[model samples]
Target chain A: DDEVITHAHGAGGGQMTELVDAVAVSQFADAAADVGLAALDDGSVQPIDDDHSVVVTTDSHVVTPLFFRGGDIGRLAVSGTVNDLAMMGATEPLALTSSLIIEAGTPQTTVERVTESMREACEEAGATVTTGDTKVMGSGEMDTLAINTTGVAVVPKGGHVPDAGLSVGDRLIVSGTVGDHGISLLSEREGFDFGGDLESDVQPVNDLVRAAMDAGEVTAMKDPTRGGLATVLNEMASKADVGIDVEERSVPVSGPVSSAGEVLGIEPFDVACEGVVVMGVASEDAADVLDALRDNPKGEDAAIVGEVVDDHTGQVVLDTGFGRRYLSPPEGEQLPRIC
Target chain B: DDEVITHAHGAGGGQMTELVDAVAVSQFADAAADVGLAALDDGSVQPIDDDHSVVVTTDSHVVTPLFFRGGDIGRLAVSGTVNDLAMMGATEPLALTSSLIIEAGTPQTTVERVTESMREACEEAGATVTTGDTKVMGSGEMDTLAINTTGVAVVPKGGHVPDAGLSVGDRLIVSGTVGDHGISLLSEREGFDFGGDLESDVQPVNDLVRAAMDAGEVTAMKDPTRGGLATVLNEMASKADVGIDVEERSVPVSGPVSSAGEVLGIEPFDVACEGVVVMGVASEDAADVLDALRDNPKGEDAAIVGEVVDDHTGQVVLDTGFGRRYLSPPEGEQLPRIC
Candidate 1:
C-alpha cells in the first residue's frame, strides 16, 4: 500500500511533524475541510470560535509491557483519557472511543481487558463507548496492547479557558501526591521489592477536578503524564507567558515514592502520574480549592504546593527547604523506560 | 511489573470475553465508578440534564505493513473513524482519539503518519482529536503498525435512529457498488495480480448520509463493516424479525471487484466495505432517497435491491439471477479478523 510508519514518528517532537504533513495529510485530504489539511497539517487554522476557547494537548505512554505492575493495558488506557479530559475544564465527558493495533499473536484476553477498562472508565465518567473497532497485524508488527483514545467533555456555561490564566500572585495547587504511579510502575519494571505496599498513582481525576473547579476559578489544570509536574507547569507558564515560583518542600510526595525516586536517580517531578492533577488558580482561592479537593475521596492528599509570580518569564523555579533554588525543566530527554 | 500482555490473552473468544470483563475494567475504574476504572478511580459521577442523548462507537484498523495500496495506516485510521460515526444517525463526529501499541523498533515516521492521518480525519469530520495516548511495546511484542481508534458522534435531536421502521413494504437500498474496498485489500493481501482501476471505497459518508437524511423518512441505515453486505441486511431483517428479499441482479458490483472476488473464492457480499452504506426506507420514499444518494459523489452507484416481506422470521432469502434462492447470515462466526 502506502509507506509504513518509521520509528522516529513516535519521538514526540519535530520529526513527528514532517510525517504528519507529508504522508498522512496527502493521502487523507478532505475537500470539505476549510483548510484541506488543518493545523495538524501543513497550514494552521485558528479555532472556529474565539469566545469558547478549546484546550489542546497530546501524550503517549510507552510502558515496557502493555500490562503493568499493578494494572494492565485496559486500566492504563482509561486513566490516560479521563486525565486528559480533566486537564481541560470540561465536565461529564459525553463520549470516548479507542482504536487498537494488536500483535498477530496477542491473546484475546488482552484486547477484552483493555476494552473492559474503557467501558468501566466511560461509565465512571458518565460517558459511553458508543463506537469502536479491532484489527490484527502479522506477528511483531505491534505490541500486544497499544491503544489510542480521544474524546470530549462539555465546558460549563460560565467556564472560561485560556492559556493566559496564570499571572503574578496567582496560586499553584496539587490535587495530591505525585510520582506514586510512576514509582510503582518503575519498581515493577526494575523488580524492586516493596516491603509493604506500592501502587501506581493512576486514577481519573474528574471528581477532584470538579471539586477544585468548585473551590475556585481554576486558571488551568493538567495531568502530568510524560514530563511530570515540572514540565506541565512549564508548558502552562510558557503558553500563558508567565513566571512560576514554587516551594519544592510544599509539593506533596509520598515517602515510598520519594525513596524509590532517589534509588532510581530520577526526579519525581518528571515521573508520570496516572491520576494526579496540577492546578493553577487565584491566590485567594488556593486554600479553599485545597479544602474542596481534600474532601473528595480521590484528592484526600491534596495540598497548596506553591504560587505563580510575574518574576521569571515562563520558567518554574523550585525553592528548596534549605532556601536554595533549583532550575527544573529537566536536564535532557527523559529516558522512555521510566514512564 | 505486571505482564503487559502475551500470546495467551489473544486466544479463543471465551477467554477474550473474560479478559475484557475483568482486568481492563478494574484498571480504569473511577472512585465512584462501579468496579470498572477510568482515571478518577472513583467513577466519573455526573448526572444527565435530560435533553440530549450521546452516540458512541469504536473502530480498529490494522492494515498490512501499516499501509496499503491506495492508502496507508493514517488514511485507514481516519476513514475508519468517520465511517463508523456515519453508521449511526449522527451528523458530524465531534472528536477522535487513538490508542497505539507500537513496537519499539518501528520507525517514528510511521507513528507520525498515522497520528497525522488521525488529525486530518478529525478535521474533515468536524471533530477534534482532543486527547490521545501512545504506548511502545518491547521489541518483538508487536507488529510495527497496529492502531485502535475510538470516536464520538453527536446524534442530532429527533429520533433519527433505526427503529426497525421496517414495515411489510419497506424497500432496502444500498448506497453504492460493493466489495471494492474488500477486494482491493484482499488482492493486496494475497499476491494475486488484479487488474483494472479499482479503488478502495474508503471515503467518509457524511455528505452522502446528509443527502439520504434530507431525502425522506428513513427506516434504517447500516454500514457494512466486518460482516459485509449479505450479513448486514440479514441483521436488519433479524432485528425487525421480518423477511428481507434481495434482488441479486440489482445489487451493484464493480466489474473488477467481482472478477477479483470470483478468482479469490471470496463472497463479494461478505467482504468488507469502507464507504458503502445499506439503508432501509418506506417503499414510497425509496426512489427519492435513491435519487438523492446517486447525486452524491459517494453514491453514484447506489442501488435499490430489496424489500421486506411478512414471512421467514429472521431468515434472509437472496434471489439468484437464475431463479435459485440462497439463505445467507454466515454459519458460525464472523471473520475474526478486523484488519
Candidate 2:
C-alpha cells in the first residue's frame, strides 16, 4: 500500500482509521489487558481489583491557535481526558498525568495561561494533576505545544458502560449541541468575520454525565470529538454490531453552527463537539436520562436523537424527515485540530 | 524574570529546573498523592488501597534519529515508563498508555517498526500497552515523531522506594556502564566517526532493578536519563538531605563512551544512560545488591561508586584519587533528545 499520513489521517476519519489499523493497532492486538488496544473505545479499562476497575484514557491535543474563544489547549487537555473517563462511566476521577512537548521560544505567559486553564479544568472535574513531563523542542520542531493527558478513574467493576453494550432497543441520546467546536476552529483558521456566539464547546462534562448515569443506566457512551457526531455514531454501531437510526431534526445544532456550516459547505452533524456525549440507554429510560441531563448546565440541550436497531448492523442511517439517508464514515479531516 | 524556554530547558539541567519551578512545579505543588509533583522521582505513587498502592509515571521521548543503534522511540517509550515504575520498586507492571504524535508524510514503515519495537519492549517488561492515542501533524510541525508513555504499577504499601530514602551510611551503586545512550546520540548528531562498539544503553533495566530489589531493600533508585548520573544523584542528595561522596575511578564508563565523551567535551557523569540505574542501599547489603545486579545481563558492570555522607548535605563531591571536587547540576542539555 502506498498509504501516507496526512492532515486527514489525524482528522479522526476513515483515513485515520486506515492509518491506525495498518500501522498501530495490530501491533498491540496480542498484548491484551482488561481493555487493551484492540478495544477502540474512548479509553482503556483496567481491573484494579475484583470489585473495581480503573478507566484510563489519553488524548494528545494539537489544536492550532492554542487559545480559542471558549477555551485553550490546557482546558481541552484536561476536559478531553476527563470526558473520556466519564464516557467509560467513571464518576470519580483519581489522577491525571500530563506529557507536554513545548516549542522553545514560546512566551512564558502563554504557558502560564494554559496551565492556569488546565488547573481550573482539573478543579472542575474533581481530579488532580499529580504527575507530568515537560519537554521543550527547538523552535519550529513543533508549532506551539501539544499536550497528552493520561487520566485514571475508578469505577464499579460491573456498573460501568461498555462500548459494545448497545442493544437493539437502546435509545441514543446526545448531551448537547454539536459542531460548535469544529465551526469555531474552522472560522478561526479561515479568519471569518461572521461570528455570532460561535465558541468551542470545550468544557468538562463529567458532572452532567454523572447526573445522567444516576438517572438511568447507560449502555455505552462516546464523546464526539475529531470525527464528529456522525463518525462517533458509526463507531458505536460498528462496535456494538447494531444499527443506529439517527433523526436528523432531533440532533441539536446551534444557530451559529448551522449558519457557519452553510457558509463553509459542511454539515452540522459532521462537525466535532468537544463537550457533547452520545449515549445509549434502555429505551424506557431514555426520557429520564434526557431529563437528568437537561437539569445540568452542561447538558441543557440534551435530546434523544437516535435508536439502535437490528437491521443494518455496523451502520448509521439518518432520518431527514423528508427522506432517509446513510451516514458514511468521514472520508477525511474536514477540520484538523477540532479537538 | 524574563526567562524563556530553551533547548536547555528540556535538557534536564539547571535551565530545566528554572523552567519547571517557574512554570510546571508550582501548579502541581498542592496536588499531592502518595508520590506527587513535589517529589521529582521517576514516577508518581498513588495510594489505591490500604494494602497496595499504584505507581504511575509518564515521560515524553523526543529522541532524534528515531532509529538508533540499540533501540527506537517505541522501545524507549515503553521501557522508559516501565523503568520509572521499577525504580519505585514495582516488580510487576500493570498497564501502559502510549501517546504518539507523528509528522505528516512519515513513512508507514517507520511507524510499523517503532510500534513493533514498542510491542517487544512491552513484552520484555511484562507489561501491556492497553491504551494509546495517535495524532499526526503537518510535515513541518514535528521532526519525525515523539512518544509519551504513561505507566501503571501496583506495589505493596510499604515495599516501595522513595527519592528521599537515602541514609547517611548508604552506598550508591550504578548498574551497568554510564553515558552509552548520551554518547551514542551525541556522536550521531556530531557525525563523529569514532564508532567502535558504540550502542545506546536504551534497553529496559527492570530485571536488574528487580534482582537488586529482591536481594535487599533499596533506599533510593533513579535511572540516569536526561541529565545523567550527576543530576539524578544531586536530586537524591537534595531530597534526602545527605551528602554524596563519589569515587571517580569507580564510576563505570565503557571505553567507547569514554572516548566519545572526550571527543565531544562532555563528562561521563553528566551524560544520560537510558538503561542504567543508580541506587542507594545500606552498606551491609550493597555487596548483595551488586552481586544480584551483576548476575543480570543488563547489570554486568554494576559498581558501587558513592556513599551517602552526613557532612556536606545536599551536595555531591567526587574524589578523583588525589583530590575532591563538587559536581554541580548540569548547566544545560549537552545533547538534545539523547534519550
Candidate 3:
C-alpha cells in the first residue's frame, strides 16, 4: 500500500509518489481529447512543429480564503489554464505545468488536498502538469495558497485561429451559465452567505469548447474570467475591430449566483464564468454554435447571448431584459483577481 | 505611454506588461514561446512534432527565514525554471509557469520586490512566465510564501534525453564552484551574524548549457539543486544503472563556502548548487564539455570532477582529498528545501 500525502507530501518522498499515483494517474487515464493528459515530461516538451500560427494570453487567480465553497487551488488551476488555452483558439491543450509558491507553516494536508484537486481538474480537462517546480517561503509572504497554472493548447488544424480570422456582424454565443464561478467565489471569499445549492462554476470547459469547434461554427472563442463577459467582449471587439450587442435576457445565470451578486453589490455580468465559453461565430453558423453548446451538460443553458455588430465597433453594450441598454467595455477591468 | 505591467503586476497585470516590455520583450517576442513574462499564462502552445521522447525532473527552493538574501520569490521563480530547462539540454525553454501560496497579511512591498526580482530572473533566463494564478488564505493558515516553478525543455534532435543517455566510463564535469549558492542562501535565509560577502550564484544556466550543447559533448546534464551535486550523481547512477566515482579534490568549492559548511554541520558536496551544471560526458568529449562550460561566466569554474566506472553500478562514492570516502546520495534527502 502506498502512503497517503501528508506534510511530508511535498517532502519529495514515498508519500508524494502515492499521492500522484492515486489522484493524478487515475484521473487522467483516458482524457476526452488529444490533449497531453498523459505520456509526456514535466509539461509539454514536444518540439515546435508549426509556423505563423500562435496565440498568447494570460490571467491570474486571487481566490480569497485561498479556497472555498466547492473548489480549491488545484481545480482553479486546471480551469484557469484551460480557459487561457481556449482563449487562444488552441484546439486541445496538450499539457499543463504548475508553479507553487506556498506560504510557510501551511499544513501538509492543505497542500495534498490542492494537488489532488488539481489532478481531478486536469483529468476533467484532458491535460496534466507534465513538468513543475516548487519553492517554500517564510510566513507573512503570501496568502494561504496561490497556484500559478499555465497550459499549452495546440490550435486545431482547419479551424481559423484568432489572429488571422474575423469579420463584422459575427454572432456571439456563450455556453451555459454565466457569473456562477465569480458569484461563488465572491460568496465564499467574502462570506456573503448566499443561500441555496450554489457552488462555483469552476469546471474545465475544454470539452465543451471542443464540441463547439467540432460543430464547425466558431470564428473565435474565449472564456470570461477576471474582467468578466464585458471585458472579454471588448477585447474581442478590439482585436477583431468589430462591435458587439448582447440581449442580457438571452444570457443564462443561476438564481443563487444572481441573487448573491445583487446582495454583494456586484453585477452578475461582471462575475467570472468558468465552464462557459463565448464564441464569435459566422452569421450563418450562429444556430449551429448555439445548438452545439446547449448539447453539452455544462452548456445546457447555452444561448445566443449577443451578436457581432459593426455599429458598436470596439465597444460591448448590453441590452437589458427591459429596454434600456448599457455600455459594457471601457468601464475597464471589472472584478480584479476574479480568476 | 504607461509601463507595460500594471494592476496585473500586483494582480499579475498591466504592470506585468511594462516589466516584460522593459526586459523580456526583445528576447521572447515570439507568440508561442513567450506568454508574457507576467507568469500569468501557462507555457505556450507547442505542437508535438515527434514521438518516443520525454524528460522529467523536479527542483525545490527553501530560501530561509522564508525569503531574502539577494533574490526573492519572483526571481527564484525564473532562475529555477530556466535552470531546470538547462539541465534538460534545451537551449530555449518555451515558458516558465509557477504557483504561489502566501501567508496571511504578507506585506505588499515584499510581494512586489519578489515579483520584480522574478521579472529580472525571467528576462535573464530568456524564459517567460506565460501563465499563473494566485490565492489568499485566512490568518494563521500559511507562512510567508512558497513557490513551485515548472519548466518544459524541448529535447534536441537525435540527442539522448537526460535519464536515458548515460553509459559506463563517462567522465563527470561540474560547471562551477559548489556550495556557494547553498551557503549564500543559508547566510541570507538565516540572517546569521557572520556576514562576509556571500553572493547567491542564482543565475540562469541556459546559456552555459547552450555552450555545452554546441560543444557537442556526450550524454546527460542536470542542475544540482535541492540535493546538491552528490545527490544528482547518485540519482544518475541509479537511473542509468551505473557507478560514479567523484574525486573531492577535483570538485571545486569556494574557500568561504567550504568553511561555512564546516561550521554549520553541512557537507559542502551536499549543499545546493545554483547557476551550476553537472554533466556526464563520454571520455572522448570530456575536454570539450569542460572547455565549453569554463568559457562562460557562470561556468568558469568548470572542472573534471570524476568518472562513471563500470563496477559500482547504481552507486556514487566520493573519494575526499583525504583517504576517507563518503557515500553520495547520503542516506536521506539533504537540505529539504534548497531549490
Candidate 4:
C-alpha cells in the first residue's frame, strides 16, 4: 500500500478496493452481518427477522462545483444513497438521513438551493429526508460544502440483490446512457462546449429499477457511479467469478458525452454515469427486463449490453465488432470530485 | 437569516437552529415520518410495521486534530452516531455505515489508526460497520479528513423516546462530568498544561444508557455535544414547553476540567461532553436511575443536577448558591470542530 493516500485510493478503482480491504474490511471482518463490509457491495443487508431485512447505504458527496448543469450537490447526495439502496433491491427507501458540513462564507442561498434540490430528489424516489445534522467549518478549513446521506430500506429477507450474484447464464443490461455525469461535469469545469446537449444523468432511478424487478428477475445489480460502466462490469465479473462479454455497440453513449470524452482524452466506459445501473438478469427474463426499463422515461436509452459467460472468468471481454479486447477496471483518478 | 453562513450557524446554538430550520426542516416539513425532521431530535423514527419501528441518525464528524487526548476522529464518529441512536431509546445498534472523505496526501498510517479506533468503538457498542463509502478530495480542497457515520436500530413500535418528552416533576440527571471532552481538547490544541488527567470522555455510552433505561423511565434524553449541557437543556426546555431549575453545585465538573475552564474563561456548562447523557426521568424513578448509572464506571460521576418545573417555561434557571440566573444556550462559536 502507498505510504500516503492519493486520489487513486478513492477513485472507486483497484486502489480504492485495496485501501478499503486493508483498513475497513480487515478490521470489521468478524462482524456478524448477512451482507457486510467484506462483500464490497453497494449496500449492506442485515436480516431483521425471518420475513424482512434492512438495507442501508451511505455516500459522501464532495463535487467541486456545488451546482452543475443538471444537478447540484443536494440532488446528487440524495440520489446517490437512494440509488445505492435500489441497487441492493430495496427500491422504496424507508428514510434518508442527511448530514451537511459547510464551510463558513458559503451563501445561505446555496444551502437553500441544495436543500430544495434534495427534497425534490427524495420526492422523485418516493423517499423522505427524515433526519439530518449540519456543521460549519472555518472558511479555509474545508471546501464549500459536503453532503453525506444515509438511506435505509426494508426488503423481503431473501429478495435483496447482490453485485456478486451473477451466474454464467445471466444477461447484462444497462439502465441508460453512460459517461454523461463525469463527462458533463468535466466539460463544465474545464469550460468546454460539446455543442450537443451534455447534461448530467444524475437522477434517482429507483422507480426504473422497481419496474424492471416487477417485470423480471434481476440476479445482480450495481449503480455505475464513480468508476463508470467498465469498473462495475469488472467488479461484478470478478466477484462472481464469471466472465462478462460486452457488445461495444450495445453500450449507449450520447453524442455530446462521446465527443466530450474524446476531446478530454477519457473513455466513456472508464468515467462515470450517476443515474445508470448495470444489472444481470436471468437469460430467460432479459427481454422483459429490457422492455420494462425502456418503458420509463429515465430508462429510455436502456439496453441489453452484455452477458455473463464461463470462459475468461473474472474478466470482461468487450466485443467492438472489429475485434475483441479486455475491459479493465479504471485504474486511477480520472476526474476528482466528479460525484 | 444571514446572507452568508458563519461559524455560529453550525455552533449548535441559536444561529444553528435558525439555519437548520430555514434550510432543512422547512423543506422537509411535508415528509411523513413518526419522528421526522421537524422534531430536530437526535434521531428519527419510522414505523416499519405494526410491531416494529426503525430509528436512524447521522452525524458528520469534522473534529479537527484527528487524534485527541483520549479519542480520535474514528472513535468519535462511531460513538457520535451510536449515542444518537441511544438517545432515541435504541440502545443496541443494528448497523452503522461510515463515509470517509479524506484529503489527498493524508498518511496511510493516520487512516489505519482511525480505522482501528472505529473498530474498537464498534466492538464496545456491540455494533458493526456494515457498509461505507470512501472519497478523496484534492490536497488543499479539504481538511485532513471528515467522517460521516449513520446508525440504524429497531425498537418496538412506540418504544422510542423523544427529546421533547419532558414534563413537570421530572428530575434531570447527568450521566458523568460535564466538560471533559471540550476542555481537554482545547487545552491540548492550545498547548495549555492543565495536567491533572484531562482527557476527552469520548466513548460509546449505549451500554450506560441501557442500564439507566432498564432501571427507570427516562422521559427525555440527549447527549451534550457542541453547545454542551447548557444548549441541550435549553432545547429540551423550549421543546417540551417547561422550565428546568439546576443546582449549579450538583452539575459534576472534574477538578482538572474546572481548573481548565476557569483559566480558559469558558463555562464548563457551555462546552461539549462526548460521553455524557442528560436525561429527564420521572421523579419517582430518579434515585433508581442515578443508582444504575453510578454502577457503571463510565457514569460513576452521575449526578441529579436539576428538575423540571412549570415556572420560567422555555428557560433554564441556575441556582448558583448565592445568585439565581438564566442559563442561556451558548451563543456564537465557542469552539469549532470540538466533536
Best by DockQ: 4
Arranged by lDDT, best first: 4, 2, 1, 3
Quality class of the docking in candidate 1, CAPRI style:
acceptable
- Compose the digit string of candidate 2's lDDT tens values, residues A1-339: 555677887888877777777655777664434566677788887776787777788888888889988999999999999999888888677888877888988887788888888888888888888778888888988888999889887677876687778999999999999998888888878888574578999999999889998899789999988778888899999998999999999989999889888998887778778898999999989999999999988989999998999999999999999999998866765776666
For every prediction, compared with the true complex, DockQ reads 0.28, 0.70, 0.11, 0.75
TM-score (C-alpha, index-matched) for candidate 3: 0.76
- Which tens-of-lDDT digit does each residue in B221-313 have in candidate 2? 998888889999999999999999999999999898898889888888888888888999999999999999989888889999989999999
Better of 3 and 4 by TM-score: 4
Give candidate 1 regions above 4 Å deviation: A1-69, A98-128, A158-164, A322-326, A331-339, B1-52, B98-139, B163-165, B330-338
lDDT of 4 at B217: 96
The segments of candidate 4 whose C-alpha lies over 4 angstroms from its true place after superposition are: none
Per-residue C-alpha lDDT of model 3 across residues B123-151, encoded as one tens digit per residue: 67766544333433434545555555556
TM-score against truth, every candidate: 0.82, 0.98, 0.76, 0.99
Q: Whose DockQ is higher: candidate 2's or candidate 4's?
A: 4
Calculate model 4's interface RMSD in Å: 1.5
**Cα lDDT tens digits for candidate 1, B206-325:** 778888978886777777765578767776777678988888888999888888889888778886787888888888899999999999877999999998999887778888877757
Q: Evaluated on chain B only, what are the TM-scores of all the candidate structures, in order?
A: 0.82, 0.97, 0.79, 0.98
Across A49-95, the per-residue lDDT of candidate 1 in tens digits comes to: 32332222223344556666666655666666666666656655544
CAPRI tier for the interface of model 4: medium
DockQ measured for candidate 2: 0.70
